[model samples]
Target: MRDLFMQAVAYTSMWLAQREVFAYRDEALQNWTLPGGVEEVQATVLAKLRVALDYARSSNAYYAGVFASVGFDPLTMRGLEEISVLPIMTKDDIRRHRSDFEACESMNSHRVEGKTGGSTGQPLKFSMSRDDYLRSVGIGLAGWHFCGYVLGDRVGVLGGASIAKQDAVPWHISRSDLALNRRQFSAAVMDDNRIAQYWDYIARWEPAYLRGYPFALAELCRHRPKGCAGHYRPRAVLTTSEMLTESDRHIIEKALGAPVFDGWGLNDGGASAYECREHIGMHVDTTRAYVETVDDAGRPVWDMPGRIVVTSLTNKAFPFVRYDTGDMGVLAWRGCKCGRSGLMLTQILGRCDERLNIGGVRTEACAGSWLTDIDRVRRWRIVQDGPLHITITLDVDAGFDKRASEEAVTLSFVSRCSTVSIAFVYAPLPLPTDGSKWRSVVVLDSARHQTRVVAEKHA
Candidate 1:
């Protein structure tokens, strides 16, 4: 009865909210449309960008300083092409001035707190209002619904949050709003025993959709109990967090006997992009977010690959205007045949910080192409210490050609970092962070020779 009442309330609230959004949609559709028709969406995004810039300049101290440094007037900014004039904000900038990121109103009353965590292990804290939280969730749900999920469908989420301590028995399950309709199993504490227990729980519940970090789901697929396939088959498996390698997708799809949809988002609780049934590339939510790709010089790069910058359209409580997410990808001009009009993200190359420093030269897309290329390798990590020294860890079949593989990897490294020395070693897999997410690459300064295991299998 209690669950039914809560469901009713959820349904009613969603209905009312959707009515308002649809009203906005109808009015907006008179000019623009969903999936973001290029010309119309571009116009909408430009207008929002101007508004967001104005809001940030006036309300966010961090952005105010940023704009002043670049000598760019937020009000007078014209089209996306001129975005190069604005200085690019990186993760380091946010970490150093965490307090300045908040809107003045929020800072004065302490109405919200800020939070941050991306490919970079450095976590940040920020603030937002209750309304901001709800809006974020609403936009996320809209994307899920676009991918065929409904409000009441049971979902399974495998993630990491420091909610429970390690070795806790019977893994406590809570009906918190944060968990929503999903049964969440923390990958942070994953072990053979815990994963077996999680599988038993999943068999009993038989959720409709499975969603979580790709690394965890891939680990689960690799180590699940034999004959467990008969118990349940989710309609689809959605992967997020870590880079969804083709091997990981293959493992997950084979285990669940279902299609795997890839998604990209941020801790700010905004859905940057989601794959439709077509599965070509993720469709950007142009109505509520504006995304741009910029080069290292912070200059906008259109019709080419570059770093991703996102500005949230909503979230007046804590504006994320022109926030550099540190991710590298391209905004392709092509649209999907699925009929959605939002901008399309061609690819998400790893994080800027995740790049391996081969000698003095930095490298990107190493993990995706090399470490994840071998089918038998379930998990791996690469740590670069200075230009000369590096280590490679692997979780793989014992029969793997370690000698040849190492030589090939060394050759690749030499090609990228011509004068650097290379080292390779196989170690026991490490564990995921508190969020059940994996790090593909970790950079270590030569001054700090501290050996830290960085990657793990996420069962």
Candidate 2:
């Protein structure tokens, strides 16, 4: 009964905010459903751009200057395709113009301020309003509902964040205005024994949904306790934070005996895409934002893969217009059979900076197929000793031909990057940084002082 009342209150508050802040969205979606076709989705996005431009021109100084620099008259910019004319904003631009990003007048002095985890090895700080916070939470909960989860359903979060360690120091779980629906288990401690203990606790909780970083979840699956394997059957498992490879997804779903869904977004923005029952690809949130895939030159790419650029329609607090998220993915131009009218993202290829270098050449391609084909095993690194070398480090697993994996991975690296050297080493894999997420590919070959990926950490 209490849960129902809380849910009612939350929904009521969300509805009021949706009407107050996103009135245009309400009117637009009145006749439309959660997922719409391509044309409808594009039209809705244009409508959102119109609304966002009005708010941005009035309140956001950053965008005002951006508009002036780009010589874009937002009023005359007709549709989503016209967005291609605007220059793409990089993370460096945001860092340099941090003050300009904020909607200073709208900021409440008491709101919480937080920094991103730099999971892509580039950290960023962004602000969120109380209402914005609520909206984000609401969208996430709604996505889970699409996958058959309810308001009070037990959920487990396996991600990294600073939480109070319950050792001698007194701690308190503060009851705040924010709706804290799920129990969080920290993945900061990578020790196998401690992780096992936490997994045991998760089983005790018997969560309906398991959600977190793909790497952490993969690690848990690798060392899953015998008795706890099938006992804690979750309704679904959702992977976020890192790219969900086919192998990892299959492993997770098989281990948990539930369908796994991928929810994609950045901490700076609210929910961008969510998988529906159809499970084809993520359906873009056309009501709140516009997404475009652009080539390296910032030109729009249709019918092919490119870097994803997103422009937020509702975030007056921060203008994320034409922001390059540093990730690569293909957005499907065709409509989904699911009868949804939102944009679809077919594939999320790794990050732009996570490319492997061979000898002296730079390449963003990988040779090995998902899990089953283990032959392409090679020692690889974006090594910066003095000059960037595609350092191939090879140690093949048993039963698989190590020599073949080495040859394939090495040859692929050589083909992409001409400056390469083969170094055969039988050593343990490099450990990821403390509290830092690992990318399968690393770009900082610091030995030669080539800093391709540069985003300063906040501390």
Candidate 3:
């Protein structure tokens, strides 16, 4: 039967992915697996960082010049702080001089080009060796296994199709998916008809696991039309690209009849954080990349939110050292009950693009300062429309001070922000829309791949 054939293909794909990840990973960075105690993990990650640094120093012209100018030596580094000696990479850096970042020796080497997907609305493209690409995918597979997946099991993926040939998946579906035992549905387009089609795919594929952007899955679940029977009961649903909020998870589980787990990753950073069976916090893969949270002065801050900077240990092709991810988070070293030795990222607050730059006054961390004081108000969302006009919606009970609440909310938003006509409404919490992921702070005109409308309170 066709079903049996797909399962066979899936098993073959897993076998190949496993073989490719481990085999080719060493071809770039030896000892891809950084298993063992915390110190061992730290040592392994640092060693790989040096390997990538050394390669970049020699084969990457831009880094070489920058290192020479700064007189920063990766091989003879004084401490981890010395890494801050290297210039921080940003999207603007990539945009300004993309080719300079490419490994000088990659002229004839096989490579895979990828783009970063987050709130910035603009995506950056970078290249890594084809083998390194497989290695990252292998790590992803390992994460999936942690959440209850076996090689060759039927799987379904929901992702926005870029619509352009360059954005279109460059790989063969059957050769990869059939061999990998998975299929993909378009998350880019989510009309009712598409939802119906997605349901049909699930009923036919009967996937053991489902995965995709959190927003896409939530939309499908929200707009699930009646009369379609989805017999496919996945053991677990995997969400990535965007943070999964507690409310979003509850709704998804209710609709799909499956427990949900989250995958945390940055496309350009080559790092991943995934939840285990314990489901407490995401176990970050420090082996592939080193993660740090630093205050504005570039000092590490604990128990407080800071800018997330990442250094890719595995990416020698374009050693992204101390890359300012522009996202905010807090990492906890107290550890987790899951017994995973790797470092854990306890919180990822939101992306820089998630901030409401009302007239220029940032209202992310301080928005709650004023909104919570309003009487009978349960929650509030700051929605930014195309013209940057603001709308503050409050969820309140009967018999509340609407006028006072509006004044407080407006005062909170327009603190120093430029002139703006604002709208205030009292209603229930706004549910998410399929067109985009939900955001407590939204720019109706902006979609930064990095924004998280909602996520598990704990993560």
**Candidate with the larger lDDT of 1 and 3:** 1
lDDT per residue for candidate 1 within 235-329, as digits (tens), equals: 89888766787778878887789899888877452436777788888877665667888888877786677878877665566666657887777
TM-score of each: 0.82, 0.79, 0.76
Best by TM-score: 1
Q: What is the lDDT of candidate 2?
A: 0.61
Candidate 2 residues lying further than 4 Å off, grouped into runs, are 1-36, 102-112, 120-122, 162-181, 357-362, 365-389, 392-401, 411-427, 430-433, 445-459
The residue-level lDDT of candidate 2 at 403 comes to: 61
Whole-model lDDT per candidate: 0.67, 0.61, 0.65
Question: Weakest 10 consecutive residues, lDDT, candidate 1?
Answer: 450-459
Q: Candidate 3 residues 1-459, lDDT tens each? A: 665676666655556545676444333222223355565666666677777788777876777778899887788863455676666677887667667675352653666777764456667777765656777876776677667676667777775532112122213364566576667775546667767877876766577888876656776676666766555567999988666666556667877888898877775777777777777777777656788788777776766778788887766555676778877777755445655655667776777666665443454633444553433444456777633366777676678766665677667556665476687776776433322344566665442211232122324
| lDDT (Cα, 0-100) at 88 in candidate 2 | 89
Q: Which ranges in model 3 have alpha carbons more than 4 Å from their true place?
A: 1-8, 13-18, 22-36, 103-108, 162-175, 230-232, 357-381, 384-390, 393-422, 425-440, 443-459
What's the distance in Å from true for residue 243, model 2? 1.5
Alpha carbon lDDT of residue 59, candidate 3? 71
Name the candidate, 1 or 2, with the larger TM-score value.
1
Q: Which whole-number lDDT from 0 to 100 does residue 428 have in model 2?
A: 40
Candidate order, TM-score descending: 1, 2, 3
